[model samples]
Target: MVTERLSMRNMTKTYGTNTVVKNVNFSVLPGEVHALVGENGAGKSTLLNMLSGVTMATSGEIFVDGEKAVITKPTDARDYGIAMIHQELQNIPELTVFQNMFLGNPKTKGGVFVDKDREAKRAKEILFELDPDIDPWEKIKNLKVSQQQIVEIARALLANAKIIAMDEPTSSLTPQEFDRLAQLISDLAKKGVSVIYVSHKMDELFRVCDRATVMRDGQYIDCVNMKDMTEESIVTMMVGRKIEKVSHHSYVTDRVMLEVENLGRVGTVKPASFKVHAGEVLGISGLVGSGRTELFRLIFGLDKPGLAVAKHTRMSREIAGLDKPANGKVIVKGESIKLNDVHEAIRHGIGLVPEDRKLEGILKSRSININMGMPSMSKYTKGGFIKRGFLRKKSYEIMKGLNLRPLDVDRAIGTLSGGNQQKVIIGRWLASGTEIFLFDEPTRGIDVGAKSEIYDAIEELAKQGKAILVISSEMPEIIRISDRVMVMRDGEIVAQLEGEDINEATIGQYSIGQAKKQTEAVL
Candidate 1:
């Protein structure tokens, strides 16, 4: 019979007046890959933080191998054979790979001096077990995101952790790297190392996890074996409602809102062109490093294009510039928008919901009202001063429309969940009367229920005749919302599909550089 490796009974955590987690029960058996899933602010993080000793639980009982354990600090958790790998990587950039692997537990000589050679040999041996190509002597800062994640995993293993908890470990990893990591987790499970996998990606969870424990609104919803769980059922349990199928409303219009000719960046986006119509959703799909993001960056003026001519039908003017100039031309409503200026982009009714929302989208220290109102401040201004009353009122209105929780305009935007933070970013532009929306991996780290809500918002924008362009790695998202799907491979737009042509199999073919067959028909 399998033994329980770890268990939490009646786990509860509260912050001031808010109860973040309540009466949550979770367990993991030896040699099991267990998933902890929930929407943002659903208490998943709070519970994990408590278990890892990053935060103290207001009330709970933790057991290790059937023996009650006391964990008041991170070291205590480590002492009990628990180690956590966070979503954001935790490694010093200046340190070497081997150095980071044996960070806290360093090798010493004669009781005092550091023994670098011995540690390096051991770190090399361990890293080779995961990836034979990684150099132990390489600096952590110079390694790819995937290699850095491997280093973190190696650290946990070096600590001899009996149970490893990972939080969105593959969020930044490539598909190939993710597959490798999945195999590594499976091997660890086979060796009797229990894993608590936390992720928002349904495909990854289903592919790697044996059992799933779900939470909602700070309460335990259910825990079930993977054989009995479907994506719909799991999502339903998360949000307490049946998530309706995403139906795309026919929004193709004759009037093209934006048009581009010869858009390209040498060594990045290849020479490509596309047109977006009013009330249309144009989805861009590709593998990592396929230039989907690079193409969008060129259009938004964040990156200079090698050769491009962009014209907006409503703008009534075209702006042409030199190859690899400081800014690309972006015409909006008859006026040529300054491509290099972010503020100018906003003024022209263009907004980018960037890939990294936490870093590029929202301000952490500012209040919700400030973060939401800043983009549309001109609307709430009187003479050069912001009208505080109008700002608060308008902010409240936008928050209500998005159903942002707490409804407190004065709360720090950083205090919100991944989903709510994204809402605030999109809300900023929506409040500003944005017309052209560019979403770069909008649902990257958000959960299923929040993804459904974001999809609804995007559809509403398209229905309102706003030109929408979405770049996503998730095939299902691209297929579901796009009226036209453009597949990018090796920095070029290889194929474009509409209506009946857009499907997973077709996209997969184009993505793997096998677009010759479909390109003739579509291009």
Candidate 2:
């Protein structure tokens, strides 16, 4: 019998009355890239945690090179040649790239002084292997998310780990960075390093993985060779049933719901122009620094643009100074108004689901009920008294509608998973009765089943006459949900596509600046 590099048999983890991972049997051969996939709460993370010694398994037999092993803590896992890069970047932002890479394990000379020069040289070598352009002396805080991810990969390699497990590592990466990562994984496999890759991106999994293990409701389903399995079959094993692809018929109307003309920030964004109808989903696709988020910030009134003009379909009152057209004009219904701030924009029936959810969407310490109710408190207020009962009732309804698990409104939102936290943020906006929704990376860091649910929710809102805008880095996401797609590159909108033109190839062509422009570009 051939000995596996890493193997687990009947691995089970339970907390109180709940079993998060149930008798999961998995293994990986040397030089193989194995994918671990499942819906949210399907035990993928839990299984990985056990292998990495972040959490102990209740019952299991772990083997390394045909020998039984014990992994009781992180140090034990490291000693056993195991390493993990979590979904979130975990690094000291103030430290330089080289400093962060060698922070815990420093090179020493003669077992006395630290070998700073040797450490820096080694760090540079590892960094160059991942991305030759990255500066080793640059601070982690200054690096983009994609750059930081590469740094994490370098750190794992510096540890000389035989097995590395990566969780959603490409969630924040650009197309170029992802390509580099794919090549890196291929090279690592050639070096006899086993990789356990976890990602919700189907295209990426099929491209890189040789085999995949699917889990559902905390139990192992089946492991299939990539050559023999299709995306549909893998998804079926994950969800235990079939989920139809989300399709949207164009709901565009001649009546403009939101319009921006000449909205430009001096050094940041250029003169951007676009219009959304009462029920259309306008998808914005771009590279990392393409100013898609910046344009959205200007429209949402989070950033002051040097030149701006915006219009909405609903407003509380007619905005002043529409005749001057100083920063552009925002017209709702038939009256022009100025959305100079977020409150003003919200008051005019516009809502923004910010890209950084934890920073801008929810308060981690607050209860789910409070987080959901805080945005629309006026509805539950009477004179000087706050209606706690009404607020609780509304929060409950929102939870039920969004299918939030555990259903405990009193629990802190921080205790929930990534997908559940997103639902709370979306539910908060729904409670406010906003007519126009702007979602930034709505399915980012979320699982496949949850992604489907969010897609359905977005389409349902469009069907109900609510205009929606989506900014996504994933090409599949842009093609699946967008009725019309606008591709941005280097702070400018280079191409716009609609109908059958919104496939991966067309989006890729435009995103990489290959599409010829017919008119002046806008960012």
Using lDDT as the measure, the top candidate is 1
Weakest 10 consecutive residues, lDDT, candidate 2? 312-321
The deviation in Å at residue 381 for candidate 2 is 2.6
List candidate 2 segments past 4 Å from native: 110-112, 307-326, 383-385, 520-523
Q: How do the residues 364-424 of candidate 2 rate in per-residue lDDT, one tens digit apiece?
A: 9998988987767888889967687888889889889889887888889988877888888
lDDT tens digits, residue span 1-523, model 1: 6568999999998779988898999999999999999888898888989999999999989999999989999999999999999999999999999899878788999979878898889988888888877888899999989889988888888888999999999888767789989999999999999999999988899999999999999999999998898988988888899988968887778777776656666667656667788898999988888898887787777886653323223122222112333333455655666655677777778889999988888889999888988877878889999888888888899888887877888899999888888888888888898899999999998998788889988998888899999999888898889999988887878888887889998888888876572444232
Assess the local accuracy of residue 186 in candidate 1 as a C-alpha lDDT between 0 and 100.
94
Cα deviation at 338, candidate 1, in Å, is: 3.3
> What lDDT does the true structure give each of the candidates?
0.85, 0.83
Error of 2 at 425 (Å): 2.0
- At residue 404, candidate 1 shows an lDDT of 83
